[model samples]
Target chain A: MFSVMPDSAVRIRDLRKTFGSVEAVAGVDLDIGDGEFFSMLGPSGSGKTTVLRMIAGFERPTSGTIELGGRDVTSLAPFDRDVNTVFQDYALFPHLDVLRNVEYGLKVRGVPRAERRERARAALRSVRLDGLDGRRPAELSGGQRQRVALARALVNEPKVLLLDEPLGALDLKLREEMQVELKSIQRRAGITFVFVTHDQEEALTLSDRVAVLDRGRIEQVGTPAEVYERPATAFVAGFVGTSNRIGAVRVRPEKIHVGIEPDAGSGGESGGPAEDGPGRDGRAEGGAGTGDRHAFGTVAEVVYAGPATRFVIDLESGDRVVALQQNLRTSSMDVTRHRGARVRIGWHAEHEFSVPETGAGTAPAS
Target chain B: MTAVAGRPAPGLRRRAAALLHRRPLLRLSLLLSAPLAWLVVAYLGALGAIFLTAFWTTDTFTGEIVREFTAVNFQTLWDEPVYRTIALRSLGVAVAVTAIDMAIGLPMAFYMAKVARPRHRPMLVSAILAPLWAAYLVKAYAWRVMLAEGGPVDQALEPFGLSGPGYGLTATVLVLSYLWLPYMILPVYAGLERLPGALLDASGDLGARPLRTFRTVVLPLVYPSLVAGSIFTFSLSLGDYITVKIVGGRSQLIGNVVYDNVGAANNLPFAAAVATVPVVVMLGYLAAARRTGALREL
Candidate 1:
């Protein structure tokens, strides 16, 4: 659930965008609080970028109202709006140097030469690019170009900043580094950031609240922990992380414990309600205790990942589940021996949540 | 390698490919030899001959090319105010034609490359090139008819209480502009096409209105192509004589003087000397353009 702010930074009501007969963004409503880093996370064609563009005034919605800082900007052009976008390609002016590129917005607004230059320099310094202002964008590395793009938008001091996968082009290490820098920049500037990315890890790492989208609709909007732990819909449960369907509930892979022996005490055919489970604090810990549910299965496969080992189990109840265990005490040979071994999977019932199955032709109970 | 040689050696084609692969410069020269020879003999050789002729003199009484090295033709060109006027007028016409073509070509190119739908772009390019398929002389004569005393141009301006330019220098510039518009549009369209659409979007997102974005972002990036287009329009207009003869009325340009001297006056040396003026002017233009890094783009 999203908290109600008195004056939200951006509020959209019944937004829809259609290209010909295909609807890119179906009717939706959202409220982004001021200074909050909110992300729209989805797959490539899931309309997350469309929603961000609509918020930035780059794309007009077919029938909806968009309010920015309590002002209606539905029909306004991008230049008239008080929000800037960090384009996916960085889009720095190739002909202009970094300083001039950053000063462009101020110059176009009639800011005097001396003042704009000083501000542009300060903006560049904020991004840790002080002496590189005279260098062309082509001369800088990809990460530097990304910083310049950020400074160019931040120098305008808009109410909100929209980034359309700005770090999508960077390598893995640089992307992680820039993610930290971006979070710091947002904090220093105190501007509401509407980040759109198909990278689920990036969205979870940087955003205060994440909106998981599927097709043209938001599957769930919540904190990263809430979305990952208690997904509202089956699509969210599947997209955010790996989940296994057990009867009427979906459980995460890490919640299920793979053991060689079934415990005598609370390992009956039917289990009781759990008092403390992974759902309480979003962590999978502790040994099986009373009220822990049990399932009989055999290890179908064992995957020895660097940090953890995954066990695929085929249950006697005709359900399949994957259980992950940290390799703190087990070596590669120890975990690899579990392949085809008879095992028992157990987890607390509170770790499971009911998700409405999408496109199953049955009405959702919730 | 010895075993392969004993097994009847590799085929000639394979052996040649192996040799060429071993020596890249040899392969490159082999590839370029034909075109290089043609370019040297047919193009640069003709230019060298013309430059050499420019220093020779024509025998005035016999009307023969004496082939004697002399500055008399150059001296005559300098002393006669008429030759200077013709050269200046030619330069003026070239500048006007280039300017007009650019003013019209840039917007047309932008619309084709950016505004038009992707499916419609090829059709728009074909339409822009449609005029180039027509004969150059036909188009020039067509403009001549339109600029006639009471023709279509004059009739169209009748309601505005204005008359046509009436087949003079303005008419020549107009005809040449029409003839060479495709050259301007093609290169500019290519440059604008290579420009990413996100750059324009980024400019507008940075609080620049469309006009400001065009001035600061679009114009600067597309400047090289504009220069490339002007090279075609400028040089083509400078060396054109037939269009002027068809629609120039009484105006005389450098091309017309060169043509008259070589034809009626039978003064080959004088014509070659006059021809060098445009060549020299073009050389200066190209050097200036190269300094701006426009030729690198071409």
Candidate 2:
């Protein structure tokens, strides 16, 4: 893994933004490393886009300092800033041909006609949209239009590229494909990308670091694994992944152990921890729980996905937990039989993380 | 075919309904065609009578068309540079008014379309066209007083130690431009109102400054509207008689010239001949507008 760059590409410190009665972006502080793939992960109305717009110089922060490549550019206009944006609508000029749209920035900067044309062609080629220079935006498909928007931004060679749900318009398959293409392009271009998306999997899959946003505030910031396994708050854990939280405690991914039933009382008391189990503490002790044995629950539902069977278990505390397993083998009895059947679900103590609760009766401010 | 919400109407009933609806349309078309045909016929007949009269030598005593054929009137018009000079002056005034209308209308239209709020935009746009809604004669009379020596404009200037020029071609041009500015503003505003805002934002993100973005992205998008508005302004100013008649005491354009020739001078043939210049110019502009795709946009 790459360590944080000493000279960050973007440094946002205590950035605050408010729109009339609503505070869209509360004080936010983030450092985006050079050439790093950074994402702001949040639900709708979480101020992720507002923050991105501020970085792109579209929205002036109410107060704070913003630095790009170690130079402060807080008061600059968007054109004066080094950042570029790919809007959700891909606002290509409907009147201009694709080539002109791509060459627009350089032309504005007074680049020579021949040189701008050559650069525009090269940018179009980079997006694999060569020979489409003659088409208008209306004549292109959704994906092609997206590529044109990319080419238009990329042609400027901006130091910071901000994507505001760029793939939000595409269908599922196309969005997935574009995700890969976008990641690869970012790598090749080696520009620091400040991607904004509400999709958790998208953020986790593409980002070197993710900042989980909630109610116009940054809840937690860490790598995908760090955020998923050790979310500082319950909101971060639940929002970033499908988490089964039991009060303030959550069942970790690998801790979700699955097995076929032995005989009745064969594993001892169902509520008690199993013998020889590496418990949550990573050590075995004489107690109701054992090493790798955390809790037991009855199977509430079993969904037979093509590759994996997802089981929802109801624990004694009435908390729900999900257990996923690959379909490596078939049992004599149907997996459906496990549904409504009393069963034991156990995991190591180390697989459970205790985090502060959210909403009403949540943990008091520290 | 019959109209349906989001779907195409099919079958014989739909076709029958569609055909039946066209009956009134056809009737309306015929009704409109009659007036246009009558005007054309009357104008042509008048031109034919005038051509014959121009050829006829005016009675030395009465100065009336004698209904004879002669080249003497054409000779007279060519012999004096005053007629040619007057004709060119009318063309110049019309051209100046049209150019001014276009220059003022564009930014106003752009502001209405892109900057004004949706609720206020209609009110603001209607305000721009308010002059057109006012009584035309009253507006012309008002301008006559305003541009006079002791009007509010002169009064305001008097405080600054300046005075009005009283009456001239310049005053007439100013009044005509004011009256017809709405014709240009409304259409250009309509064109800009139809343009989407997303296109502007996209241009900005693509690194275009505000001015560059307006020039390349916005101006081209509203080109048809601009042309349509300019055509209306040009034709209206060229063919206008009211503003010039009221404001121009002696500095008259072709409109006044045509009027004075037809009624006072009793020179119908020469008046008809003078009117033909504006018609030919308008037709040329209209052909150019159509070729450039402005008509479809309008």
Candidate 3:
């Protein structure tokens, strides 16, 4: 479908970076398709920003060949590479007005003045920052500066635009609004955007494909739903959202069904909190749930968030597991009203996925 | 509580604090009075007396202060080619020193702040500032010894078949740039240190090469500090007559004119007029530097 254009906008092969004895990005291989809105989601030290910087040619990888549109640009300087970055702080020049800042890249590349101005203005207009060409970055609000940073990069029409937590500095409401606006801008521009963010929800909301990095290695790469619904590793399950560890098995807290309370010793299968009747929830199933699984726990605490009530459960013989129940009705009989109540948490066999107790066994997908 | 035996007197301290709290103006005056007194009395007062004397003249032969209000000194200043030459030569030395110091200090400061490892940065700064510890005259004499016809400078340049420019405007500029380099380096270092690393990366990511980034991003941001540092170099170089005396073999800067007229020639009025040149030059420089946001940095 991408005629003449390389299938992958950016191809990272065995990319690795190390600082002294510490490896920041460990042998990551990813092929981000052209026009794809991809996100690298990880914690602060997970090497997500480092990877983005390497792709932008800001950080040199210790060993890797990065290909942009089928041409290797691993050794090229940032200016030689056809990509730009929207820095977290926006990094707009304080001395220059918005127009000069936005036109800086084109000006450096020797684009004609009229053409540079016209393109910079159009880019600013696209970001909804029209009529702000004369204000210095210090004069603009945080949101306006952010849009100017975006406009500055977008004006370059680079092969890939790298963003390192571009919305991280905004307030919650502004962040959400900018998230939608950024995604829409990505769609309109049709240029590949490789965004780095620690916010999983933001990643899920904005990315077409998401890659989870942990301890400088990619744990999983898939569609947002795939990574969120079916986490490939224990870290993914824990980091992406909330997950309940029912013994060795990991299941989504939202997928588990909670019963009012369980009897101390009911040994049957007919929904009597039993152990044998379709209660193949036997401990022999390890973590990957077999058929259906049932566990008994006491609801030690109930947290009432607006839409959902999270019940922190103390399983009979394992670590605490949490179950989420949506408050469909506005009645006051919340699960909180039944704190210290014994509850039965069960999930379908398919809802349960096995993960390594530790992160030693996974292999990169290449 | 019982009456304290070992405690220091609190009544006086408490009463003073209470008085200050009741009248903040008293606290403000207490904080400002000493510096203000020194500045007005020791600095501006002397400047006012000197400028006033520039309007008076002395007897030509009697060697007595006539103290007559006259424009003779200023007229002589306006009509003399010697004064013009000295003024222009001094101005040239100041400008050259500032330019050379900036040329050397910028890259050195950039290296110290950005390129050097953090562990080594303090050592670099100390080395840059270490020369200031030696007395100025001692260092200038040392340079005098080094710049002699067959001295260390000649020895160093002998292998290259080149010789140092000894004891002239060039020598004065070289010594002044050497002395004022740390002044320029420290401020520019501080300015570069305050620059966000992300800005450099952002500029490069925006398709600016290293030189381009330095020009557009680094230069503009650090320009104020450059101006601030130049103030020290320019003003100090302009007013210096000692280095010119030791290493300036035959050179006559404005400072030399002031010293000769005031002391050797016994023409205080003419000396005051000559000294006024540097003061006016500096005021003009400061006014110009203000537009570049240099005052805020200073």
lDDT of each: 0.86, 0.79, 0.86
Q: Which stretches of candidate 3 lie over 4 Å from their true place?
A: A1-6, A260-292, A331-335, A359-366, B1-10
- Top-DockQ structure, candidate number: 1
Residue-level lDDT of model 3, residues A38-153, one tens digit each, is: 99999999999999999888889999889998999999988889998999999888889999999999999899999999999999999999998999999988899999999999
Superposition error at A70 for model 1 (Å)? 0.5
Off by over 4 Å in 1: A260-291, A358-366, B1-7
lDDT of 1 by residue, B159-185 (tens): 999999998888899999999999999
Off by over 4 Å in 2: A1-4, A252-316, A320-348, A360-366, B1-84, B194-198, B202-207, B261-273
Question: What TM-score goes with each of the models?
Answer: 0.92, 0.79, 0.91
lDDT of 1 at B204: 89
DockQ of each: 0.79, 0.48, 0.76
